[model samples]
Structures are given as C-alpha cells and as structure tokens.
Target: MGKSTGFMEYKRVDENSGAVKDRIKNFNEFHKHLNEDDRIKQAARCMDCGVPMCQAAIRLKGMVTGCPLHNLIPEWNDEIYQGHYEHALSRLLKTSNFPEFTGRVCPALCEKACICGTVEDAVTIHNNELFLIEKGFEEGYMKPRIPAIRSGKKVAVVGSGPSGLAVADQLNRRGHSVTVYERDDRIGGLLMYGIPNMKLQKEVIIRRQKLMEAEGVVFRTSVDVGVDIKAADLLKEYDAVVLSCGAKNPRPLAAADMKNTKGIYYAVDFLKSTTKAIIASGALLQDKVTLTNAKEGSYISAKDKNVVIVGGGDTGNDCVGTCIRHGASSVTQIEMMPCPPVERSASNPWPEWPKVLKTDYGQEEAIGVYGHDPRIYETTVKEVISKNGKILAVKTVKVKFDNGKLVEVPGTESTLKCDLLLIAAGFIGCQEYVAKDFGVALSKRNTVATSDPDVYTTGVKKVFTAGDMHRGQSLVVWAIAEGRACAKQVDEYLMGYSNM
Candidate 1:
C-alpha cells in the first residue's frame, strides 16, 4: 500500500536463527528480528488487494484459507510502512488478543493466502507482526488498561491457557470482575509448559500474566476446579462460568497397557516436567535456586538415553529438540502417515492450507546435530521391548492404506534400540472428569457438547465451554478467537446484549 511496486522491489526477508552449535547448548529462542527499516520494507510489500484474502477466513475442503481472527493485515501493514509503529500495534491488538503468542507459533495462514505468493514470495506478514508488537513493548506503548467502571458482575474462567486468558482479558476490559483458575503451579496452562522455552520463552508468558493482573484480572494457581475447589461453588460465587479447559486426554499409545515399562511418558507430561525442573533449578530464571533440578525424581531425563518419539507432528518435533538439548545419545521420531509432498498438490491449490513439507526449528536442529533428519514416515511401533520392567528397545513396522484401512506390511517389521519412549500422539479430547463433574454433555468426538449449535452454552446452566475443550486440539490463534466469541455470548446471556 505504501509503494505500488514494492513487492517486486524488495525480497522477502525473515528472522535468522542462531547457529545450531550455539543454540542447542541451551533452550533459549534462536530467531533474531530484522531491523526497523527492513521490517517496514517488508510491510510495504502488501499489495492492498481488493479482496484481501489474507484477512478472509474462508473454509475450503475443511481447511482454513486465511486468518481465523480476520486480522486487519493490509491496514496494519500500511501503518507500519507509514512509520506509525503504535498505530500498527493498535490495529494488531484490535483483532488478536496475543499477537506475540500467535506470531511466534501460528503456521501463518494469512501469508499463504497473500496475493503476492501466487507467483513470488508472500509479504513477510508474520515477521512484520512480531516486529510491530515487540517494538510496542520496547517503546512502552503496551501498558495496563484498567477499566473505568465496574459492571458488578463476576466471571470465573477455568484454565489459564490461551483461551481462558483471552476470555478473562475481554471480560475484564468489559468491566466484569474476572478470576482465572489454573491447576499448575504456574499461570499459563500449555504455554508455560507444553511449549518449550526455545519456541516460546516462559518469561514472555509471565510478562503478559503480570500485565493482566495489573489490569484487574485475578489469577489463582495450583487450584484444580472440581478437586481443590468444587465446580458447584464457582457457579454460586460467579455470575457465569467459562470452561476453557484444554483437551487434556492424550490419545493412548498402543503400548500404553505395558504398565511394567520403566521409561515411557506422554509428550505433554515430559515437556511439563522439563520446565518444572528448569524452574525449580532456577537455571534460566535469575532467581535463587530451590531444587537442583525438576521436582526431584519426577522427570524422565533423556540425558545419555536413546529416545524414541511415537508421533511426527509438532509435539513430536518438540520432543526431538528437547531430547537434543538434554544431550540424548540418539533420537528418532516415528509417524504413521506418509510424508507430505514437498510442494502443494494440484487439488490443494493456493489459499487452502498448504499440505507441504515444513522443516521446523526442531527438525533443522536435529539435522545439524545428527547429520540427518530424524523422522521415520509410514512407520509405527509394533511392540515395546522391555526387560525387568525397564525399556530396552522397540519393534516397528511399515504401514499402508488398504481399502481405507491402515494395515502393517507383512515383512517390514524392524527394531530400534529405545532407552526412553515418549508418546507424542495428539490428544483425543477434553478430560471427561471436568465435564462430568459440571454435568455438561460431550459430543461424539468427546469435546464438550453445547446445548445449542449456535451458542457456546453447555447443557449445564450458566456453564460455557470454549477453546480445545469445545473444538478439540487446535492452534493458539483459534483458541483466542473461540474465547473472544464465547465471551460475547456469555455477556449477551447475562446482560441481554453484548457490545464486545
């Protein structure tokens, strides 16, 4: 918008990573930001297309085409290009409750729909967004915005994950007294632990938490609803209750029944333990040390162990990186699905989520360290080999689709030495106990079932569900969107109208 031919004049520039050798020594973030002028040039590349598909959240073949939040992309790009940094940040914050989180982790659905990418590289929208937000923070433009008035209504948000935080933030700003409950010792549910410090630093989540607290949102940690506090009690105290509890029920591994195995863990549990250890040790945070390392004896350390990850999605990739940082002897990731194409297929054209290969930071670091990619496609564990209740190895076999069913090949079984096995298979749905305790129904897929298809209300009165609890496992961006939408519904239900 700033320059008519800027797309042709400037090449797409992205953040560079610290060298693998230096970065793997610790779990700090490796990506470095571009300078201000370069980021402005990147923003200038926005074409200001008439349709602006980058902001259009169209669904094609069950895949999202653009940003689900419908971010004002071109508008903010113009603001950045015009040297209005605060204006750019304001436009960004209008649509996204947490640009810093989405900017770091989202797959950039907006960039894939950019008109410039039809032939050449798309504008560096994601990088530009990060630059704007981080610059806002550096310039002290981001501050606590305490509401001027109170509506005299209170809301209890269960879970301190992205969706719950979004709900609390929105409702607090709307003048409602909001309280967030988290089961973990820390506030951020998944962000604090599920994601490693390398991808999203723990301090970033804490910084936002402090800001939210200053703005009048109360945070309660180590308080598990239905256990530490009764679910019925929250309904009696608050005008409304919002369930942003994530999908915590992990899909069980086929070898889960091997109770005698010594070194098996779920991916989320493993990642959470590492963070808790890091926190307890005060290794990263500049605080007085408490425990030497993760709550003593709670963690299954990958140090000097041959680790095998059972899934090949993002969680599995995270395991690969974490094990590498732990100095694992060797690591391997297994995926049952065939490897995706290196480029988009004919049927999977532009605007649809690109079904192409993505070599994330973890995979890249694994290649740098191990001298080869660690992923094994079309393969799955056949049996967990153990001796004296200790894991020793794993037998795997190649699989293929036969009449819409996956069947293992007859003679492709093989074994890999596995000292530690981490199952990164994705979650199934929300934990049933929370929904059952609240007397809310669940859909056939096990996600929370709403009383009405058009609303977020659960079968239980005054109880609402959002985020992964309602939609199943999804991106942080979607969780934020769902939370905002659910908040509007709750506000309307309480006040008979909503201006959110």
Candidate 2:
C-alpha cells in the first residue's frame, strides 16, 4: 500500500526481453531487467490483499497452486512498492535461497495465486523479484552469510541441483559443515545440463555456487556417491546424508516396430551435448562439434534437416528453439494430448492457476524464425521410418483419449519427413543405482519412499532423501521446499532438535 491507489493507477508491466532475432544467435540470457522507477511501478500493482492467496501453496484438482516455498509474496510486494529493494530482497531470502534461479526458470506459481489475478492480470511479482536480486548483486549488497558457530557436524548432500544446494545452504547456515557431491563435471546437476544456457545462464548458477563456497559449503564434482564412493562409507564418515539426486530416468515410448534408427535420440542427451559444446567453445548456433565417442558417426546437423520433436512441453519446445537456431530447414512439435483452450474454462475460478495457451520463450523464438507455431495437437509418433540405419521419416497418427488410454483415430495417419527424431517424453524417477546400492526402499513409482510427509528418512538408517528423489519430477520451487524441509528433518535426527 505504498500509494493507497497505486494498484488502480498502474497496469501490470513485465520486463522486456531482448529482440528474438539478435538473442537466438547466441546461447545467453536475454530477459532485460526493468529499471528502478519502472520496477517500482510494476510492484505497485500488488494490492497486498488481506487474505493473500499467493503465499498459500494450496492444491486444486491434484495440481499445485501458489508458491511451493510458501514465500510471503504480498509482504515483499509491499516492500518493493515502497521502494525498499533491500527489504524486499531480505524478505524473499527468508524462504527462497536462490531467488535469482527461480526468478529466471520458475513458472511462477505465486503469480497465479495472487489475489489481483482472480479477475485481472496478476502482479508482476516474478519480474519485480528478478529486479530486486539483480539490483542487490549490482549494488554490492549481496554476499555470503556465513554461520557464526559450528555444530561440529558434517552433512553429505548427494546431488548439486536446486534441492541439494538448498539443503546444503540451510544446513551450513545452521552451523553444520556441508559437502555436496555431483556426478557432472560442473557443480550444477541439471542446471548445467538439463537446462539450456539461454534460458538460465550457467554463469548465474556458478556465481551462486561461489557465494555458497564462501559460506563454507564444500562441493565435489564428477564423483558419484554410490559408484565412486559407497553409501555405507558416507553414513560412517558423515553425521547425516541427504539425497537430492533428481528424477531423470526418462520414460521410453513402447513400440514393437523397432526401426533401430541411428538418428533417434533422447532429449536429455541432445540438450547436454548442445550445452557442453556451447560452454566448451562458446558455440551455440549452427556450429557442429563431433564427439570422439559419438556412437553415431558424425553429428546430425540440424542445419537443412527436417526435425520432428515428439512432445509439446518445455523440453520439446527447447529442442524446437535449439534446432531452429541451429539452422533447421523446418521444425514440427507433436503432443499426444489435445490442445488446451486459449482461456481458462468455466470450472477454473479466480485465485487458481489458469492453464491456457501461452507461448513460452522457446516457442516464441521458433515462431519468430519459422513463421508459425510448431506444435501439432492430438498427435503422436506411430513409428519411425529409417533407411540404411539412418532416420528418414516418421509415421504419426491423431489420437483420442478413451477411458484414460490413448487410442489412434482412424484416417488421420500421416508421415512427416524427418532427418532427426527427438523423444522428449518425460522422466520416470531418480536413477536406480544410488537408491538400490544404499538398500533404501523406493516407492512403486521409483521415487525414494518416505513414510511420512515431512520426514525425509528412508528404510536405511541415517539416510534421508529430498527433491526429485523423494517428490518425483517437479518445479524448481518444489525442489527448494523439499530441500529446506528435508534439512530440518536431518537436523532433528543429528542434534536431537530441529532448529533449521
């Protein structure tokens, strides 16, 4: 309530992104932050309602709503409205350890739950958050807040993704020594490989890691816990162990045809290779790099190739953008589910997250270059056709849901010429190696089994699990929440009290 009538006077204004033509040329962040006055104006849109739903992480129809970290959005929005940037930042960090990461990558559950969004556009909470943290960093107000005392306890965090980082940060701040182990060469597990640099700059993650280092969090890279080291070794050497290894075992399409194609690849491998090339040589667009160990001889250049991406989610859209930027002749994305309505339906009411047709960053970039939306609704690949062990085309068919199962609709069969086939289906759960090695019982779904909601312990003693390992694949905010909550459980197990 900075200006009594500020909400009435101001319209929601988000930060402007860089021009698509220039941005897609390189793998880098392009979302420009709003200036001081502009950001305050945007923040003024928050009414700071009496019953702020944005702070409540509720669920409706089995889907999550509001901030998963349970951030005090209205409180911080009011702070930003009054031009209290530092205060807003302080309030933000109370729950979220990495606002910068969430600010860039999160789909913003808080915005959907904003009271202002019931009937109108929501407050620009996400943009304002980005502005506040970026300003904090630029003004030299951001630094590592090292713990004042040591509890003489050591904690081992398996995985360096959002959840693992959040757990280590909180545990370290609670006067415990924390060490994070990552299987990747870089510290960021998924952020380094699963995500593209253009959306979330790898440098942003590295910068945060440096701050955590100064705060006395030790990071070990390229060393797997279950393989290189043993789970029993960790339990004996460390006081507590928290697992945040993400759900990344991809679900493969069941097909009996068995084209045995060479060009068919998992979406994760493509994204990982693309990011590696970009980081290794500062090459992102159209440039070809050959891996010595590439089983498929020579790289499948997206340049002048007809590419069909099977899946219409963020990962599929990422492939679309990357291929277009890589000089693909044409691109098409197909989703098995029917296309969503352009607007929220009658069943969906205010203060609930609206699921509607919205163009994401990658889709927008693809449309800018390719002249049309690349997605095809209600379609799935029937079979991949290859010649001489090389992918050439794919047969697709329109599908309809019948009793919750996909059934092919007759007379809709079609063949799409495709030189490359990328399957962006989805993940199953956490990798089985570590969980099996530790003898920790997993749920039928393969996620680390937790007997209680808040308690993170598994069947194995002194072993705890969090993030995707426990909760399955989810948003970044959920990962952070799991990490924070999991650390509290670990604290209770070690010191006989849970101050964290």
Candidate 3:
C-alpha cells in the first residue's frame, strides 16, 4: 500500500515518448522515463485498497484481467513511495522473473483491473516497474546471484523465450543445473527477433542474457533440438526436459493461394530479418546510426513499396511501424473482425478486461505519417492478384458476422495495389515437429497435451512442457508464470518434493 491520500493528491503521468516524426527515423526505444521524483509520485498513486485486484490475476468473461505473474504491485509501489528501491526490486522480483521485459511489452493488464482506475486513470504500475528494474541495473544491484548449493538435478529447457528463460532461471536458482537450447543464432527467442526493435531494444535482451550467463544457466544457441539434435538424446542426458518452444506456426490465409507467391512473407520472418540485419550492422551498439541503414539484401525492405498487412493485432501494428521506418510508400491493415467500441461498454465493467479500441504506437505513427489510420475493419482478403509469380494487388471484401459466422458482402469487393503483403494473421500453435520428436501428445489446440490441464508433465515420463507450446499463444507474463509452475513440477520429479 502507498500513501493513503496519494491517489487523490497525485495525478497520473506517463513516460514521455519521442515525436513520431523523429522516432520513425530509427528502430530504437522511444519512451523517455520520468525523473526519480516524478516516478515516485506516480508510485504514490497506488492506494491502500484492502483488496488489490491489480495483482489478483483473475479470469473474467473468459479473459484474464490482471497481472498473470501475480506481481506484488501494491507492495512494490509502497516500497518505491518509501524510497526503498532495493526492497521494491526484491519484492518485485519475488513473483516476476523478467520485469524489464514485461514492463516494456505487456499490455499492462494490471492497470485495467486497478481499483483506482475504476474512477480515474490507473496508477502507472507499468512505468513504475520499468523504472525500478532499470534503476536496479543502473545502481549495480542487478548482479547475478549464483546458487550457493547444487541439487545435482539437471533440467534441459528447449527455447529461449520468456517462458524458457523463466524455467531456466527458476530451476537454476533452486540449485538445479539448467541448460537452455535455442535454434536461433542468439538467445531470447521472441524477444530477440519476433518482436520489433522499436518496441523493445535488442540491447536489453542481450543484457539479460549476459546476466543469466553470469549465473549457472548454460545456453546453447543455434542448435535446433528436433533437427540438429534428437529428443531421445536429451532424455538420456538430462534428468528432465521441458519444451517451451512457443507457438510459432504462423496461420496461413485460408482464402488466398499464397503458395510460391513472391513479395509475400510471414510477419515474424520479416521482423527477424530486420533484427538480424541490425545486429549484423552493429547499429544497436552505436548512437545516431539509423537502423534502416542496415546492410542491404540482409532483410526484407518495405522501402518505397505499397504494403498490405493482414491482421489488426499487435503484430500487424508492428508491421505498420516497421514499414514506416523502412520508408514505405503506403501501408494498409486488414482486419476480419469488426472494430471495437471506442470506450468500454456497459456490459464490460471495471475489473474485467475492457473491450475497447486500443490505438498502439504503430497505429499512431501510421496516422501521423499517412494522414489516416491504417486499419480497415471487418474486411478480408478475397484474392491475391499476382503476375509472373509476384504479388501485384489484393482483392478484399467487406464482411460481417451473422449467427456468429462470417459472411462477405459481394458488391463491396475491391482491389488495392500491394507490392508487398505481410501475413500477421497470428499463430495456430506450437510447431508440431518439436512435439512429435519428443513423443508428446498434443491437445486439440495443437499445444503439448498434459493429462491434467494444470499439470506440466506430458504423456511421456520425464518430459514436460510450458508456455505457448503447452497453453497456446499467450502473453509474456502468462508464459513466465507457466515457466515458473513447470519448473516446480520438474523440481518435484527430480527430488522427492519441491522446495521451490
């Protein structure tokens, strides 16, 4: 709990962001943090509500409404208010493994469920968190804490995403020998490549990876588990194996013949190419170096091209921003679902996840540069017009829901010039090859199946699964929570009981 009257006295102030005109020039973090005094004032906005729903992590109307990691928001806010930075960080780190990552990328579900937000703007929990973690690092309090004792248990974690990193961090902290495997050239799966650099700088991920390496965790990158190595070998080598490869199988457009089509790419692949190029060019380590100036032919360039993005989700939005940075001629986003209400409806009450329009940074940039919002709601791509195996344009049609079924309006069909088409339609589930190699049963949703939904153990003994690979595509906070839970299960299996 913070100062009892702080909520009434202090106003909410968020981190200042660079102007869209300037930020669009490079792929770097744009949000400028509030000074220490201002940040403390924001932390003081957390009221001493007897029941802090911000940390409740409850399910409402089929959607999770609060921090999935169950972060101790109130306690940390109070600590920050009291000027106890280290104490605040300790309490913060108790539940969350990577606050820095969540603080930047999380949609801040905790703020939506905040009791204070029911009447006014929510406390800057997300900003306060980022400040605390960054302060800890700046003040040299984020040093690695190598385990004092070893449990002699070995756990092999496949994947370096938040979930996999969480599992490795927890099990290693509990004195287990943990080795993380990643197929990519570097650590941090989604954080390293899937996400756009503007949202989260690659340096932040590299910093964390360095700290993790300083600890006992072993990371072996660029070694594909199912391909470069076999699951049976891991089973024989490690005491327990946890699959946290994540939901990476991109969903294809059901209506279009996208096969062998030029100028068409999956959103993640596009993002990865840009990230790889930036790293290779050393732009991340330099100041004032435009990220767009990365080595040519190393990445997909949206420069001077009319771009069409399918899907109105976060990935689609990211594509819009990346395209702008790439100096795209024009950009458009297509969403099959109808646009949400601008404000919360009566049915969508407080403490429940609000179903309202969210104009993210990418959309704002698109609007600023293009003079219009890039999203076209309730529309689907009807046909891919190609010439000589290359995409030329796309024919789209207006659609509406009838009896919960999508129906397209025949007369509303129209074609738009599209030199490059990016499919951000989201993922179906975890790629099946990894699950198949591990001999784990898959759920109907294509996630690794467990006898009990709450359990992490798979059909095969000594094999476990967590994160998107186990629960389907989800938030980073949820992935971290799942990883923590799975680590406990692995510990219990290795030892007679888990003290983790």
Candidate 4:
C-alpha cells in the first residue's frame, strides 16, 4: 500500500558494502546503511499488487519462495513511505521478533517473490527492515517492556538459538516465566558462534540478550540439558518444556582418511573458532584482527595456507570469506552438484525460488583476491592424502547425475595441494543425544516426532520441540515461526486457552 505508482516511479537501491580489497583485511561488518530519506524512497517502491506474494510463504515446485514468518511487507512499506516509523516498528515486531537478524542474514525470500521484481528490481524490503529496527534502537523505542502481570507458569526452553529465543520471547511476553538454556558459554546459539562475525556482529546479539534479560527472560549458558542437567529435573521444575536446539550434526565427508587428518574441520567449528578468537582478543573494540596481529593458537588460521572447502551452500561461501580474511594463499570450493544457469531458465520462472548462480560476499572476495572464481562445480573429494596425520592434499574427481544417481566420471581425478580442508556439506539431522535423553521419538528424517506434521508437542507429557530440532535444518525465519507457534501450543496446554 505504498504510492499508487511508486513501483513505476522509483527504482530499488540497496545498502552499500565495503570494497572487497579493503574489507578482506579485517573481520568486521562491511555493509553501510542508507540515510533515512533514501531508505524511505526505497520503501516507496513497494507496489499495491492486491495479492502480495512477498509475504505469501508459498511452496512452488518444492521450494518455499516467500517470507516464512509471513512479515507484513506491504503494510510496513506503506508506514515507512509515510515516515510513520513507530507504526512500522509495531507492525514489524508483531510478526518478526528480530528484524535485525533476518534483515542481515536471511536470503530475502520476500524480495524474490516481490511483485515489483517481475518487471523491474525488487523493493529493498530487507534493508528497510534493518533500518526500522536500528532506528527503533537508536531512538530508544526498543527498551524492555516488562509484562504487566505474571502467569506464574514457568517454561524451560533448551537452545537459545533463533527458535528458542523466539519461543522465550513470545512466552515471556504472554506473562509466562521463560528460562533459556544454552550449552555454549554465551547465548544466541547459532547467532553467537555458528555464523561468522563479519556477517553478523556478536555485539548485536549481546545487545538483544541484555534487553531480553531486562524483559524478565532468564538465560543460563554453558548448561547442556542432556548431560549437565537431567530432563527429569526440568520436567518437574517447569510447567512446559520446549526443545529448540538446532540441527548441528554436520554431514561427514565421504573421504575415509579425513577422520584422522589434523587440518580438517567442520565449517561451523572453523567459524566459531575465528569468532571466539576475535572476541577473546577484543579485536572488535580495537583494530581489526588480521593474520599477522591475531593471537597464536586462538583459532584455525588459514594464513599462507592452501584451503579447500567442501559444499557450495551459504556455509561454504562463509568458509571461503573467512579463509580470505585469514590471508589464505589459495582457495578452492568443491561442489557436488552441477553449476546452475547464470539467468533464470524457461523451466524455472518467476515466483519460484530462482535456481541461478549466486556469488555471495565470500566468493566475491575470493574473486577479487584470486582474480578468478574459486568454485569447482560437478566435483567432489575422492580422497584425503595426509602426511603424518596432517592434511597434505586432496584427490578430487568430476561427477555427473545419471538417472538421478551421482556417478563419478573416469579419468577425471586430479590432485591439489591442500593445507587446510573445511567441510560445509550441510547437516544430516538433529543430534540424537538430546532427543534420546528426553525420551522423544524421532522422525525418519531425524527430527523430533509429533502426532502430526503441524503439531509441536512430543509424546512425552508437558514436552514440545521446535526449530531445526523439530523440523530438520531450516532458515532462522522458519525457526522463529516454529517457535512462536509452539509457544502458543504450550500456552494453551498450560491455561487451556491461548491468545498468543
């Protein structure tokens, strides 16, 4: 509901990013926001399409193409265009608990499904969201809102990830006491460590954590529920229990020798180490942490090393960027799937998740530094050649999908010198330990089982599950949506009614 002809009159403008040559020298956020006036103009590009597909969250050909949280994109855009920022913030918060997180990290499904994109560029919905949330914080409207009354019912949330945090936030706002348990030393499970600092600054999470604490949510970090604390204790103490621990079980590389390789690491582990080292050294407060000035043994550094990354997803791109920032000598990414088309093909049309090549910031940095793209498609690691238990090189082979089955091509095997190998091949499912301890059944896909797909309650009494743990690995927006829905179910179970 922006201007009647706004979509036709205005063009989309995105936030500026730091130059690759300059930004690769440090571990810091690179994107700079547009000024208020320019941001408003961008919002004006939202068209009153009558049937706004941007927030539809529809599934077409097995791929979801809109905001999972179903954010009120058009309404907020109208408010932003009219400079009613407070109204925009209210509408935004009604659906999304953390615009700041999604705005920065989400792949922008809304933009992909935007009506404006059919004819021209899509509206800058993601940037506008970040602008709104940041403005709320800057103007002091994001202060803690203590509940007027307490329901006196306690809910124990395991995880403190986006899903867990959303569950805790919604339940706490409904006057129920919520305590989030995290296994790590800090809160914000994935946001804290799984992601690299440059993509999402840790201080942003810390700021939200502080505000949540002020709003009466209790957080206990470094407390692994299954091992450190028994499930029985939590069941007895809380009125309801919601498990939101994410699917962190990374898929292992097929290379047998990789198990004993010293220089091999999971993508998340590599990212976490770098983030921890950055925080430990207080690099964010001081100058940037570069290869030379970084503390020794603080992280798995890639400086002057030949790096090879497995997988071609977002996590793999992140590994590429991190390696570049670590001053890698050379970088290579091996992808099992064939390369996608540069532009949308006839078979894949608009309003479907575009199956096109996306060169993320990581690949961009790699190209700028290496003078060529690092991705090697239709290829996979055939063997890990190690020397004295340390990785030395990788033997790779080109592959093709024949009758929907992957088959390696003959005589295409090649060897490359590799010092460090990072696996970002995605996750198989949720880890089994927590589900086993809770006595909850798991689906065939390795997610928590319920009576129905939409249900969140587990077979165990007073217990429920949400997020990646319940639905397998998914986006942060989906996790937040699942958390909110699960919280409503918990509220109804506790009081026999829920208006959440």
- Per-candidate Cα RMSD to the true structure, in Å, reads 1.9, 3.0, 1.0, 1.1
Model 2 spans with C-alpha error above 4 angstroms: 256-259, 282-301
Please list the residue runs of candidate 1 whose C-alpha ends up more than 4 Å from where it truly belongs after superposition. Answer: 286-298, 451-454
The sequence of per-residue lDDT tens digits that candidate 4 reaches over residues 367-475 is: 9999999999999999999989999999999999999999999999999899999999999788889889999999998889999867999999999999999888888
TM-score of 4: 0.98
Cα lDDT of model 2 by residue, 1-500, tens digit? 44556778888777678788887776667777777787788777878477777778888877777888888777777788887878888998898888988888888888888877775688887887787788789877798898889999999999999999999999999999999999998887777788877778777888899999999999999998899999989989999899899998877866413356677777888788777766555333324322223333234457788998888887888788778667788889989988888988999876667878878887888788888888999998888787888888989999999999889999999999988888888889989999988899888888999897677999888899999889888888899999999999889988999866
Model 1: lDDT equals: 0.88
Model 3, 221-256: lDDT tens per residue?
A: 999999999999999999999999999999998755
Q: Which 10 successive residues of model 4 have the least lDDT summed?
A: 285-294
Estimate candidate 3's alpha-carbon lDDT, on a 0 to 1 scale.
Answer: 0.92
Which runs in model 4 stand beyond 4 Å of their true positions? 287-294
Query: Model 3 misses residue 49 by how many Å?
Result: 0.8
Per lDDT, what order, best first? 3, 4, 1, 2
Clash number for every model? 1, 0, 0, 0
- Clashes by residue pair, model 1: 277-294
Order by TM-score, highest first: 3, 4, 1, 2
